[model samples]
Target: MEKMTLPDWMKEAPTAVCPASSGKERKGFLDRSLRNFASVLKRAFASGKTKDGPMQNLEPRAKLAGFFLLILAAALFESWIFILALLVMTVCLSAMTKAGAAPLLVRALPAIVFTAVMAAPAVFSFVTPGAPLAGVGGLTITAEGVSTALFFVLRVSAIAALAALLVLTTAEADFFRGLGRLLPGFFSAALFFTFKYCLILVKTAEGAALARKSRTIDSRGVKEAQRWFASRAAFILKKSLNTAEEVSMAMVSRGFEGRVATAPAGPLGFAEYLWLGASSFFFFLSFGF
Candidate 1:
């Protein structure tokens, strides 16, 4: 290959110049934060794709009720086997619903790891009483304590997986509508608006970051970046408040009352009843184990 020649300006430039301080640019805190937030938000919203899957055929209310019952059972159970069973059930359900396992695992791993970290101290004899298994300086790891910690971690993971499955399978509008039926109108409306505005804020922050990046020529120090991030956060807050007001006015213009009104959903089919019955039976069986 022929050698490429540098321009006079490039040849004269310092070779040791930091990429950020040089003409070449690097993404700053705001840029990175916004990009990451946007990606997560996108994945979360995108997961609600109701295709021709098992969950899509079920009535929203039935799905909501069955999930809650299963989650309640998971919460009440103490056995590691029971918790593992619930986790397996969640994975199976996600598969039936055609929700990708990778995405579900990605979402659940953080919560699972965090729960383990929080439960770590419980394994020590000083925190939980039990026969000693292993010991370090001034501390003993006990068998009972390890068992308790494992149970806690498994329970948390099971619950998180189930919750992720529900979100992945259900559409946003249908999910919110189900909530409106089960909850007070004001609470449901607030939740709906909160979710709506959160997406709006994410988009707004992303746009702001892109705008800043386009205008920026040289990178600033960490302190300067921190100040900018703080100011950007304040601006996003203000914009959110203003947008909320506008949305409220728009709702008023459209004859919306203080309550959210959802159209009546059709009655549950026989398949739904069967699923619900199976869910209830499993929940009851959990109490025995």
Candidate 2:
């Protein structure tokens, strides 16, 4: 083998050294928040790709009606036990749909946390007057308040979980088309547009946040961050207006006259009937408390 000479730059030490990074460049709070929010939305919408499941096999209209009944039950029932039972049922259905627990938790966590926070006030004595269950830093948590809070949190959790499961198992197009069939043409069109608009807004916000983060080399002061946020908000608002105008123009070009035509939803079968029966059973059971 022939010996090769090394390049001068490769053999010699560099005159100047590159500066070390001043800690890893972390994403700003808003950037991270937007990224996560966008991720959740994408996952929520894309989740119906699960190959096979009982829920997936059922008609969208049946799933919609059944899930609505369950959510209604959750709202109508005051008993914590009923709510807890509904939550358990939802979990079971989620499992059958192959909607993994981790994804369910990811999808449900924000709503669960928000519900808990909002219900927290109801646990205080000042909010719900009753016998004191416990004392924390001179604040009395009334028993009734505790009960009320628990009930509220559980109900919300059950409802949120059920909603998540419904979305996870049903394809977006089918679900929306079924919804269009169930609702009046004008209302369904509005809902369809609103859903699409929200998704677009989330995607736009995520892209804006990421672009801002990429451009930001140094940490900024609160005022600078606020100004950046305001600018971004205004940009998003303007973008949305433009998007709406474009959508309206496209719709008009397509001969839209305020009504969106949707294909008829599939007829209910045995699986759908069973689902409805189960939903009805639980709904009636909720009444017994």
Candidate 3:
């Protein structure tokens, strides 16, 4: 049998030269990417059996209700002081949860930064008319604009921190169960499955990237790399569809009927009642003050 050989034109083609990256550089890039991905996964799925975390012992429904109440307060208030107070409460509660402030802040940093960036434009007099605080040519920073931006940032930060704290302390299943109680049956199931699949997709992408990095020995041109990535993305999309179908079939086989049913919530304790009352009072107070 004759062995396969390159065509005459391909055999005669000139080898293209590509800029070479050091193995160390490639390894460093891969490590940083993987570490970031891992951190996101860790933060998203954080749930521990802490002995005395602030949110650890609360019923899921109670925690969910409290979170929404505080979030509503945060949203409705325009006062920077109130927003700061909420931020402090969130930080203090998170500390009591024993989930390490550093990790929580790190995980929430992206959202915080994004919110700040999005709100930064509002600080200019052009976007928000008010008394000028400072100016460079026609671009003036107004006092009212500054206050609005600060309030926006603080409100967003508080809400994000509260959400992170809740998710970190509460088990994912319990959180979903609590959410299921509030939402319609089909919507609850969809939300749960959507979030579940999103994580799976992230994991799948990470694995694919690592595999590609392991096999890659030489640096390629930007065009080649882009093409490869596009192909890989298409492959992942196809794979995800197949996986989703399989999951749906498996769930149906196990008696899933587009509804997520969780165990009935138990009676609220004294502590839960107190927490609810305090949250309600604060929420209402935000309106008056």
**Which residue pairs show backbone clashes in model 2?**
none
Misplaced by over 4 Å in model 3 are 1-23, 27-35, 46-51, 257-259
Stretches of candidate 2 exceeding 4 Å from the true structure: 1-23, 27-29, 132-134, 197-207, 210-216, 219-223
Q: Mark the 10 consecutive residues where model 1 has the least summed lDDT.
A: 16-25
What lDDT is obtained when candidate 1 is compared to the true structure? 0.82
Tens digit of lDDT per residue, candidate 1, span 168-211?
78888878877877777788888987887778888888887767
- RMSD (CA, Å), candidate 3 to true, equals 7.4
Candidate 2 Cα deviation (angstroms), residue 35: 2.1
What is candidate 2's lDDT per residue for 1-289, written digit by digit as tens?
A: 9899998899886533311233343656785677677876777667547657777878888888888889888888878877888888788877877876666676787899999999998998999999988998988999999988887888889888888787777787767776876788778778777877888888778777767666666667789888988998999899989988998899899898876677756677888899899998888887778
Each prediction's TM-score versus the true structure: 0.85, 0.79, 0.78
Tell me the spans in candidate 1 whose CA falls farther than 4 Å from its real position: 1-7, 10-28
Tens-digit lDDT track for model 3 on 231-261? 8789889988999899989999999887666
Between the candidate structures 1 and 2, which one is better when assessed by TM-score? 1
Q: Count the backbone clashes (under 3 Å) in each candidate.
A: 0, 0, 0
Choose the strongest candidate by lDDT.
1
